[model samples]
Target: MPAFIPDILAAIAMVGVAYNLAGAALAGRWRDTPAKRPAATPSITMLKPLYGPEPELAVKLSGFLDQDYDGPIAMVCGVSRADDPALAAVPATARTVIDPARHGSNAKVSNLINMMREVDGEIVILSDSDMSVPRDYAARIAAALEEPGVGAVTLLYSGRGETNGWSRMAAAGISWGFLPSVMVGLATGLAKPCMGSTIAMRRETLDAIGGFERFRDLLADDNAIGMAVRELGLQVVVPAPIVTHSCTETSLAALAAHELRWNATVRMLDPAGYAGSIVTYPLVWGLIAWIAGACWWVPFVALLARLALAERIDVITGRRTAPLWWLPARDLLSFGLYVGAFFTRRVDWRGAQLHMARDGRMTAEPETRYP
Candidate 1:
């Protein structure tokens, strides 16, 4: 190796650490910003797509029904199975759509297509079943959409572990890994992410995007939807008061499979941005510096900077996500996933094996495999 190569690697790693530090500071300010609650909340129809039973499923779904928004709100819970366990949690007042119809390979988008026909609200909200929102979630989202020229509103989310060590680790990955990256991306104007965390848009925006049918075959449907909204020359606004995404994995395999699918989805959608995410994992870069025979101080400073950034994010989010002991392991795991994403397009999701095409569409594979 060239003598100056290790120094270059060390420099790159330090830049990544500094980036995360700046992101954490920005996150603190974003988190402290006052929630923008709507003055007159409009009628809302929340579309929740569910599959099988998950930890805290009922408790989390119940939170959606207890909202404090002044407008009339209707919840639609869609499931493919007639005997799906998710049905038990559906509030009696909320409509339930049980359809086994397959519209392309994306079950969630198909579920939404079926659920959409029954919606009757001025604003449509698409949130994942595993998320829990506060009583004012509807009002805040409605307010965000009412902003001029904003076609869609998406909420940022923090991970909430339901049970076991794996679950907590999954949650930590979101808080320490994903959330900060998203903040940095938004700050740098490098990302436009529309997430199932909470996708709020007017019915007209949905129609303009060609409705749920357009996303039925896509792997990164959330981002695809965001792109559609942007095509109409309108912005997708991400508001404060991050929602809670339940990280309920019980085993390492479950967590790995879920995150791998996520990594593949994002990488498929934006290859350049995904590849550039390497610099965000400073600990992994630090390990690379050590392997390249950089001086011991190189990795030592990198680790300390990584730890400092993690602590800052933890304080900003009011959660202990990256404890010093677990920070290195998490960064390595994240880096490994990023590498794995380039090697395969197959993902295991919702008890099915699916192959992702270069265009980000997914098709079912005959046999299931876990990464």
Candidate 2:
């Protein structure tokens, strides 16, 4: 390697450290001012698509049913298979839809299509089964939609570990790594994210977007929905309240596969931005620069910067999912997964292997091998 390479690496690491500090500052101010509650609360139907039974499934689902909103709120939990054990956990107060119909490669979207037939409320909310929201979640979402020209509302999410050590590590990645990056992107106006954590829209907006059928084959279905809404000359807004996403990975392999799928989906959606995201891993780059004969304190400075950012996120989210000592290992593991995502487009989803096309469409295949 050239002697100048060490200097270049060190410079990049310094920039990454700066980014970490900037992200921390941005996160402190990222949340929007709480939207005032509308005078009238419209009826809401929350569409929760579940797969197999996960850790704390019952507890998470119960949170949605016990909301503080006064309007008539209903939850529709859908499963593609009749025999899926997750059905047992669905609250008796909520309606359950067991549909085995295969609409496209994405099973979750198919579940939503079936659940939609049973939706009776004027407002529709599509939230993943793994998420748990606060009592005011419905009120906040309903108010955001009532804003002028707002097509949809999505919530930012922090992570919660419900299972084991692996789950905590996964949670740390979301709270410390992913969440900060999202904050930076939003602060800079660089990302338009419509996450599945919570997608609240009126019935007419859902109909305008073709009613979930158009997203049946897309891997990043949430983003596709947001894009379609944007095309209609309306904004998809992210409100102040951050929900909780339960991390249930019990093994290293499961965690790796889940994050790799996420990384690959982001890469496919925005290749250039994903490539530039290398700067998000300052500790990894700092260590590489130190090994290449940069200043001895470079890696230590990176570690401190990362820790500062983690502390900021914890303070903002109001809970720390993993110990601070575990951050280095989590960061290294995340960096490895980031590199691995480029080698293949194959991703694991609910015990199925799917190949992603450049156009973001996914095709399901036999479980022959793992990436």
Candidate 3:
């Protein structure tokens, strides 16, 4: 190797460490948008697409049903088959939509298409089955949509491990790694995210975006929806309420596959931004510099920076997902998955193998079952 190579690597690592420190500072400044009830609370229809019985499925779904909002709320849980075990967890108050039809490669979007027929509310909210939110979630969402030029609203999320050790590891990645990065991205005006944690919009806005069918084949359906909403010259806003996403990975393999799929989706959505996210993993780059014969203090500072960011995220979110000592392993594992995402277009989603095209469209392999 050239003698200048170690110097170059160390410089890059130092830059990454600086980025981590900046992210920590940004996280410390984070605040949730105060919940405000709109003067007129429109009727809301929540579409929940379910595949199987995830951990705490009933509890999470019940959180939506017990909202404190005064408006009439109707929730429709969609399942491809009537015999899906997930249906057993649906609350008696929420209606169930059973359709065994495939609209596109994305089963969840297809489920939404079926559930839309039953939607009767002036406002529509689509949330993932694994998320649980606070009592004020509905009121906050409704208030945000009342803002002028707001086409849609999506909530931020924190991770909660609902299963074993591997689940905690997964949650740590989300809360510590993913959450902080998103904060930095939003602050820098580099990200426009519409997550499945909660996507709320008026029925007219949904109709204007051509509904969910336009995103049925896309890998990053939520991002695509946000883009579509933005094309209509309206903003998709993220409010103060942070929903809880239950991480239920039971083993290392399960955790790896799940995160790899997530990283792959992000890469598909914005290849350049995802590639630039290498600076988000300072410890990984610092270790690489150390291996390349850089100074010893490089990796040490990188570790400290990562720890600082993790601590800040925990403080902001008011919850700690894992121990500080577990961060190095989590960061290393995350970096590995980030690298792996670039090498493969195939990802596993709810027990199905999907091939992704450069255009962000997905195709499922033959004989594959979607949950």
Candidate 4:
């Protein structure tokens, strides 16, 4: 390697550490203050799109129904198959739609399109199947939407790993890698992400954006929905009070495959921003610095900065998803996945092989798509 390579690598590592420290400061400033509940609550239709059985599916599903809202709650759930294990977990109070309607390549969007027909509430909230929210989730969502110029409300979600080691690693990836990146983006006004953790919007707002059908072919459908909302001159707001997403991938392969797809999706949405995020991994850059002949103390300081960033995230999220010893491995794994994402436009989603275009549209392989 060139003599200057070590110096360059060490400098990059220092930049990454500074970037993480900035993110930590931003997260502290953006801490969520509790929203006062609206005096008049609008009835809400919670749309849950399910594929198969997941760990703690029942508890997660019920979290939506057992909300503390005063308005009538319509929990409408859709499944591609009647035999889906998720069907058994659906509360009897919820209106279950087992429709095999393949509206487009995105099955989740198709399910939302189907479930929308039976919606009975003035406000519609679309959340993924694996999230667990608080009892006052409905109230907070309602209050957030009532804000002027806010077209949609999306919440941040922390990861909840199951008993398995791989599951914990996946959770760490979320709490450590994904969550801080979002906080940094939010603070810098670089990212306007609409997560599947929870998307609360009025029915009229949904219609104005052309509904779920508009995103039927998009891979990053949640962000696409946010874009549509923004096109109508509306803001997609991300509030505090993070939800919980079950991280139950039992194997490293499963975890890597899932995160690779996520990284690819973000890359498609904002290539420049995604490229700039390379500086978010101090540990990876730190290793490169050491290998390139940087002083040992340089890597040591970088590692300490990475740990401090992780601890800050844990404090913000109120969950210790990644242990102190696990930070280096988690950061390296995330950096590797980020690099790998650029080489492939294909993703494995719920056992389906999906081909993504540069425009973010997705099409599943015939052999892998559910019938």
TM-score of 3: 0.96
Q: Model 4 clash tally? A: 0
lDDT of 3 by residue, 1-371 (tens): 99989888888888888887888888754466567888888999988999877877998888887988999999999999887889989999999999998899888898899899999999999999989888888998888898999999987788888898899899999988888777777888998999989888999999999998998998789989999999999999876866788999999999989998999989888899999888788788888889999989989999998898888878777788888899999999999999999988798988779998989999976434434
Best by lDDT: 2
Instruction: For candidate 4, write residues 1-371 as lDDT tens digits.
Output: 88999999888889998987887777775465665797779999999998877877888888888988899998988988777878888888889998887888888898899888899788999999889988888998898888899999998877879858888899988887788788888878987889999888999999998989999999989998998999999999987688888998999999999999999988888999889888888778888899889988777888888788778878877778857798788888888999999997899888878999878888997534444
- In model 4, what lDDT does residue 4 have? 94
Could you give the C-alpha RMSD of every candidate to the true structure, in order shown?
2.2, 2.2, 1.6, 1.6
User: Which 10-residue span in candidate 1 carries the lowest summed lDDT?
Assistant: 362-371
RMSD over all Cα atoms, model 3:
1.6
- Give the winner by lDDT: 2 or 3: 2
Model 1, residue 46: displacement in angstroms? 0.8
Please report how far candidate 3 places residue 3 from its true position, in Å. 3.0
2 versus 3: better TM-score goes to? 2
Considering summed lDDT, which 10 consecutive residues are worst modelled in model 2? 362-371
Per-residue alpha-carbon lDDT of model 1 for 263-341, expressed as tens digits?
8888888888888887887777777888998878767877887777677767766777534688788778878878988
- Lowest-sum lDDT 10-residue window in model 4: 362-371
- Estimate the lDDT of model 1: 0.83
Give per-model TM-scores: 0.95, 0.97, 0.96, 0.96
For each of the candidates, give the backbone clash count.
0, 0, 1, 0
